[model samples]
Target chain A: MVDRHLFGLGLRKPHYGAFLDGAEPVPVDFVEVISENFMVEGGRPLDVLRRVRARHPVALHGVSMSIGSADGIDVDYLRRLRALVDAVEPLFVSDHLSWSRIGGFNAHDLLPLPYTGDALAVVCANIDRAQEALGRTMLVENPSSYIHLPGEMPEWEFLDMICRRTGCALLLDVNNIIVSASNHGFDATAYLAGIPAARVRQIHLAGHSQGRALLIDTHDRPVPPSVWSLYAAALERFGPVATMIERDDDIPPLAELLDELALARDIASDRERRAA
Target chain B: MTLRALQHGFRDWLTSESGPLAGRYPAGLAVYLNTYRAQLMACLSDSYPMLVAWLGEAAFAAAAATHIDGSPPHGWTLDAYALDFPVTLDGLYPEDPEVAELARLECGLGLAFVGPDAAAVDPSRLGNVDWEAAALHLAPTFRLLPATTNAAAIWSALAAGERPPPAERLPQAASIAIWRQGFTPLFRTLEAEEGEALALIRAGHGFGALCAALVERLGEEHGPARAGAFLGRWLGDGLIVDVN
Candidate 1:
């Protein structure tokens, strides 16, 4: 488990210039960078990441590592990822709690896992392998699923089993919980309450879009009012964990995102004050 | 079931029609799987919008679905998944040179976006070098595309959501240079002689050798000076990484 807590925002491209100029530093504890964006040979992305890393503690949020795939982990991908982690030296590393490949082909989407015991074992082993290769404790974030697997344990139980077995950490995405809960007809609060608090090392709050039948975790809008409420509940339960706001599309100016991050910071600080 | 067997079953279920495994999932499982297919198709479409526009959305979706069925995702990153698309599409659209070229350009753009970051050599770094003997190191972000067809014009038009003009019956081939100068990736059409010069330089030819290639192509009278001018423009454009 991580000792220090964080309150940060996702480092996005639209905000790169402002972020580098220090024109709009979000009043948060740190920042999280999408790992693949900066994994380049040389360009503005790395330059900006270097500048931001100098000012704030940064954590890497990876999209590809397909940790739950049936095929053994991609060794070359792991090597490149390891090289990046070493270069960036993030607070902690994390990827989606899903599989993304089958038969050596990459679908690129974080496809939902079956959540069966067999799937759990495969995920745990993959997590163990990733952690060993990375030489650091990595967090796994729960994916927002539109459907549940038959005979699968509750998502919370699946997460609990994995963390207990692999010694990995959790990056609890509050928006994902609300979105998944709404889609699958589960109680969001109960899902949060069920998690072993000690395993949660970070929190991700993002905006979502409403689809015809399901709430898509789009990360393209403001944090919904209910997600904010859920975030407060998460803070109350998890204590001061690393929190970040992820906005991937239709990105507002940096100041607007910073304002949203400030809200998360205030909630965390307020909760800490009450506890004290 | 063993992990391997479950994986095989899941792959078969995903790629082929839903059969016995249909019993294992709830009524919503089909819905989820259908959504998954749509999502994958949407992602592929978004990544290769030009190709979709060229092939028409229906055809593009069919081809993308076929590709997905044969090659399931293995990497955690989506960027790498579209890498082999051009090669795959080439087989399907063998008669359509436009289809293959547009796919190649889209894949190239995706690659440029996720390619490794290297420290760009400041132009001032070349001040100490002798221009005649110096061999220029192209930035890792630079890519030279030699084409027998007008791929760049078609790509630009397709990207802008417009249909390209009909291909001209020209005997001469064209080449394009794709590189990320800052954050944005750029594509510029290169003259035949210029492309040859860059190819020589990329192959570790010295300035003299590059000049010789330019002379052989453009003729001795204009070759050396034209090549010199081209190098100057390339350096100014930040395409050259080092001169050693």
Candidate 2:
């Protein structure tokens, strides 16, 4: 979500050597890293991240922010993340639209939140606290949920309300929409249509698996045709957002991911052609 | 339900099976349970890879399950989940002392790998210091752990992808020193006297008192020489960060 069309990949361990070599660039406009992985006191992890930042623009994506915690936000977490943000000066800083911590116990997974007015207030307040502490706006990604708690609004309405209330942005995950739509029996297109397109600054494309009775967001494989199709739809709506292919497990070589990013470029090119 | 009550319901479902959330959302609850346990187990496996290799997968998995059942994660980060695993290993293998010792060594090395960064004092700068009054400040990452078995040797072998030796106790008391050097985590065994000396320094004892203790143990002739030798080793190892 810089001012131009952009494509990238989630930096993982398997491709560290390729990305850090610095002889030839990894063909990414920017590389997104899990902020917590590099948020250490000091060591090779931070050293490698600094080296990579020197090569390409970076994005700080987090998993444990727990923005919708009913109890409150963790100020300690915000302080550490702020330090990393200042160091990297990344293009975008993001976490999921979910809560993981409550009453001193951290679930460590993105737990679902009801889209009721109360939950909306909690998320907005937490996001406000985070943005103020970070001294910059943050993007909150839509999470793929398995269970739907009793709520008054849909997930898109909730996201729109959050951006309006906190002056934040959005990192729309295409695969999460596909998975959640299929799991909860909602319309994916309708879900996309409801989001505020102007506020979406980034897009996450990944793969999922079929659970016994629901779809799970297991980012362990290549992006599927369904996800690609949804990505095309999302691009059409959100217009050339910063898109990336995220493969967390069973990570292929750097070459394979680049080929995937190339496909994203092709898709975006195709969209622009139609617009013309 | 109120958001607080709803979260507590989710917590009960994850920590224990007896909760209203489970009955209402059986299929979804199953998915979460599996993911929670699997992620915690994977964390233990990652943090203690050597221990997993030493204990083999099945035994390590069982021990991890017990720990997860009793210790719900409290820290915001998953790395803290590995902190209490060594204690769990102790309870599970009371007679097999090597198992827990190996876990302790691995965990300590992991901590030092990301501990605070400090620049070791240059050896050439030692001549200007007033030795009697100087308090030798060790590296912030420096950690001394008790050792009753040959866990350090076992760790080395496993890291090199070689077959580890049978677990055995040492003839005398010992400890292991873990710290980082130039972005690499390093460890070495410490003799009983050296371990006591380092512990004293860590507890804020000055170099003069350390020499006096050494002199009291070994006669006046060798005591000062031994103290000087210890200082040289510590300096050479990049363990002493400052002297004041």
Candidate 3:
């Protein structure tokens, strides 16, 4: 985990110039990037990442780990990710607790997983292989799902078991909690209460769009009021975890995102003062 | 359902026109299907902007939909999904050969962008080498894309945001050489003689053979001179990684 409560933003393409060539450093404590984008042999992407790493701490977040695959974790993917981790020496490495591949066919989207004991065993085995291969513990984030597969336990219970069995931590995505809770008719606050609070090492704050039947984790807009409230509650529980905001589409100016990071800092500060 | 059975069910629903997983996931089957298709489409559209421009937006969308339905992604990286699209274009627009050729060029450039890096052979180091027995090793990113039409010109025009010329076939076939120079991926249309020599080198031929072949075709006097010129150009282009 990071040294302390850190606020950061996703280092996207449009803001690469600003982050790399600015007169002053971007004010965030760290920057997160999609790991798959930089998992290349060598190119401009690696060059840019090296330059950026010189300025700020980076977190490697991936989308294709498919930790819940029934067949098994992709050993080749783990090897490449381990190489990237060795190069970046990131503050944290994380991927969603969802499967995108099964039987060699990768759908390339975060597909949902049932919370049954059998699925849990598969996930734990995969995480064990990943952590062993990477030589570092991973942070698995809960995903927002539109379909609620019938399972033996709630999502929080499943995550608690994963943390216990695989010795991995949590990258709690508050936005996902809201989206999934609303879609599956679970209590969002209850989820925050149910998770292993000490296991949360980082937190993701993002925006979502309401689809016809469910909330989609779009990450396009600013962190809405609802998500902010949950983030505050998460800080109260998780206690100053590393926080970052994600905006993948229709990106605005970097200053706007910094302002959002400032809000997160304020929330953590408020929680600390209340504790005092 | 068992975990394996459930996954196969989801795959079938996502990859085919089949109904929603035997009514097990009716709530968000449409969402998963939409997300799956949209992600693949966006990947293709992003990877082949030049092709998307050459083929209008609607036609490209239709082609992307067709490709996505028939081809499920198997690689961990979504970038690999775009590599096979040129073949799909070949099947879709066999009459317009430029379409497939343009897609191939785009895919080659993309691959070269992230391919293994190697330093070009230093000219100073080449001075004492035995010219006859030395084997020419090209950069790992080097790719030879066959061309029978003016696809390279179309790609260049579209990349420059200029109006592309009408698709036309070349009177003679040629090849395009793609490789990275420093950090930039580059491509050049190779002359027929140069293409054959490069192909020979790529296939592990020694410098003596290239020289002998050029000498055989262009005769000894101009052949050696032409071989020297090719060496000079390859070294300058950062294509020759090693001459051992």
Greater DockQ among 1 and 2 belongs to 2
User: Among all windows of ten consecutive residues in candidate 3 chain B, which has the lowest summed lDDT?
Assistant: B17-26
For every candidate, the chain B TM-score is: 0.85, 0.98, 0.97
Instruction: Report the lDDT tens digits of candidate 1 across residue range A125-145.
Output: 899999999999999999987
Error of 2 at B182 (Å): 1.2
For residues B72-144, write the lDDT of model 2, one tens digit per residue.
Answer: 9988889999999989888999999999999999999899988888888899988888999989999899999
DockQ of 2: 0.78
Reference-based lDDT, residue A231, model 2: 89
- What is the TM-score (0 to 1) of candidate 2? 0.98
The digit string of per-residue lDDT tens for model 2 on A28-142 reads 8999999999888998889889999999999999999999899888878999999999999999999999988887788899999999998998999999999999999999999
lDDT of 3 by residue, A1-276 (tens): 555699889999999998999998899889999999999999889998999999999999999999989989887788899999999999999999999898889999999999999999999999999999999999999999999998999999999999999999999999999999999999999999999998999999999998887889999999999999999988888886899999999999999999999999999998989999
TM-score of 3: 0.98
Best by DockQ: 2
The lDDT per prediction is: 0.79, 0.92, 0.93
Candidate 3 error regions (>4 Å): A1-3, B19-22
The reply for model 2, stretches above 4 Å from the true place, is: none
What is every candidate's C-alpha DockQ against the true complex, given to 2 decimals? 0.40, 0.78, 0.78
Candidate 2 chain B weakest lDDT stretch, 10 residues: B17-26
The C-alpha RMSD in Å for every predicted model, in order, reads 4.1, 1.2, 1.2
